[model samples]
Target: MIPGYPKETFFVPDGIYLLSHSVGCLPVSTEKHLSDSFFRPWANSGGHAWTNWLDNINAFTQALAQLFNSNAQNFCPQVNLSSALTKILFSLPTPTHRNKVVFSARDFPSIGTVLQKYCKTLELEPVMIPQDRNLADPQTWSDFLDEEVSIALITHVVSNTGQKLPIRDIVQLCRDRTITSIVDIAQSAGIIPVDLSHWQADFVIGSCVKWLCGGPGAGYLWVSDNNIHECQPDDIGWFSHKDPMSLTMNNFEYAPDARRFTGGTPSVIPFTLATESIKLMHSAGIEHIHSHNKKLLSRLASQLNVNSPCQPNERGGTFVVSFSNNQKALQTLTSAGVHCDLRSEGLRLSPHLYNSASDIDTLAELINPLLGKRR
Candidate 1:
């Protein structure tokens, strides 16, 4: 725990606790926020809820917008990024003749799975760009750009490889070919800078539970204004209406914003907790937090590069780091109290802003010998 912050009053001390990208640890502030919301839900519910909800939500969205250098109006609260993605993907207007969606093999399964099911139902194609060693080469992506590509979904940072994709360039590529670009920012959200407005991306899906330090079940979706008119979600609920409880029968008006993506009553407790977590991140300053995270990743990589299976050039830039398949080494480190995770072929260390240099040193001390033994 850093000085002055004093651990924010709540955190579990067991385990190495360096998996913010996977699931962030809730700060004490969030604990308080949820507790307060629980004890006074009626006081915090309805128009009063919307009033306070919108206030906190707007603040949360504004902070995220600033992080992405986007307009606050373009940001809307949702259950999570996956729900948002489903809303947008399912709501797209039927394309003329070409109905295929294109994305990379490296993208998270959720993106592809949703598109695949949607395409099957629509009698369209799902074109997945092939990967070379789990890396989606830009040329392959460009080559897939054609009349058949109605939507091009990609991730800003791969959850598995931690590789950061050139989302801006991909956006431009999609626009030139008239393919809608959807980017999943879950793994990259707070740890890196993303200017969705500047990038001109059509849709951005992300979660608050990752680098943002929010607890589980909290996420957000950013939709470009132009794309809103193209979406007519079939799963629209009463909350999606412009005036959900207007007491008028047979009158439905969808919100002229991204709020249309959110469904029925949300998990308010998690949302409240998430809001507090964002406030904490904002108070710390996102840029400072990002810098701190980068420094930690840099140090971790430096320590692991010694006789490691993967080369420096192959490393990804986020909090997660991947090494070529080394389960034995991973098990060795895990058993040593240096908490790290592995996926398929790599060991990932996703440290948050709260972690310190001493943490990195501790992790290195345990893993170095393990790698040496492997050699």
Candidate 2:
């Protein structure tokens, strides 16, 4: 872990917090950023506040780029993953033959909800990947993509089961097949390394609230340098216009970079919060966070009498512990001051760098009653 890091950066409580996978603990610096970067500028500059407020957007992208290990120019800020995915889905050229957007049942429900609406559009279809199948191999999705597939949305790490998909191979396969790849790194952004160049991903979507510690409303989308020129998003507004100030509605030329994916007026508050979180994470380093979590997770996993769904190495920073009644188990832990979350899979326990081994032990010990077996 980054030495003397989380102790200074995080504002976590004394109790065990095993829900970083769901929503991260807020940074102590959040209020400062929100005030200085957002409200102070707005109150002082009045109507002219767009100057540094816009600069905060740039800074936010830069922070995310540092976190994602990609170009700041390629990252476009959004409100949520659903909106980001909406842009990508609507931006696609209406196909004459190819019609499928392939994803699994285990994929984030919002994605399925978005695609379900678009599937009815001309030349757009939805192809379901069986979540019941083994995900141990990263190349598992390669077999699902064929000529009929127009786009592929892969969840790098599943939200419920904490299954890390084989996105590198899947993206490569999409490239080989002339298909578009949109990888969702919502659960993986802070906990796992998502190098766009390494994966050769066409597009990547993530959020700042979880893992990044940025809080809610900062949704992020990264468009690959190679794919920008080919995409002309239909979901754009004044911001996406090449010369937004030109004010010629009839003449529509997009900003030549990832800003091409941007639309309408932007949200300044979330990015202000996100900027500090991303910067803090960059200072701490993704690898360090991953390493620390792995060690902490091992401690938690060892104490669980119930079977953990994922092996320590296979998942991201979290794992699922099943129970006869997962909700009751979750309530049992919560009432005792152990704050974890429940999902379709089971009780989700995610330990970040902020969580100590003692915290993990406390969670494990407190969860004994839910295991349906005596400790």
Which candidate ranks first by TM-score, i.e. highest?
A: 2
Give per-residue lDDT, candidate 2, residue 184. 91
Q: Estimate each model's TM-score.
A: 0.88, 0.95
Tens digit of lDDT per residue, candidate 1, span 185-273? 88877677667767898988888888777777767788899898777877777767876677256787777887766556544555677
* TM-score of candidate 2 to 2 decimals: 0.95
Worst 10 residues of 1 by lDDT: 307-316
Candidate 2 regions exceeding 4 Å error are 372-375
Candidate 1 segments exceeding 4 Å error = 1-12, 41-59, 133-137, 247-249, 306-325
Model 1 residue 358 lDDT score: 81
Tell me how far the alpha carbon of residue 270 in candidate 2 is from the true structure, in angstroms, after superposition: 0.6
- lDDT (Cα) of model 2: 0.83
Q: Would you list the C-alpha lDDT of every candidate in the order shown?
A: 0.71, 0.83
Each prediction's RMSD over C-alphas, in Å, is 3.1, 1.8
- C-alpha RMSD in Å of predicted model 1 compared with the true structure: 3.1
Give the Å shift of residue 292 in candidate 2. Answer: 0.7
Candidate 2 residue lDDT tens string, 28-131: 88888789888888899896889988999999998887777788989999989999988887786677678888888988999988877778765477888887
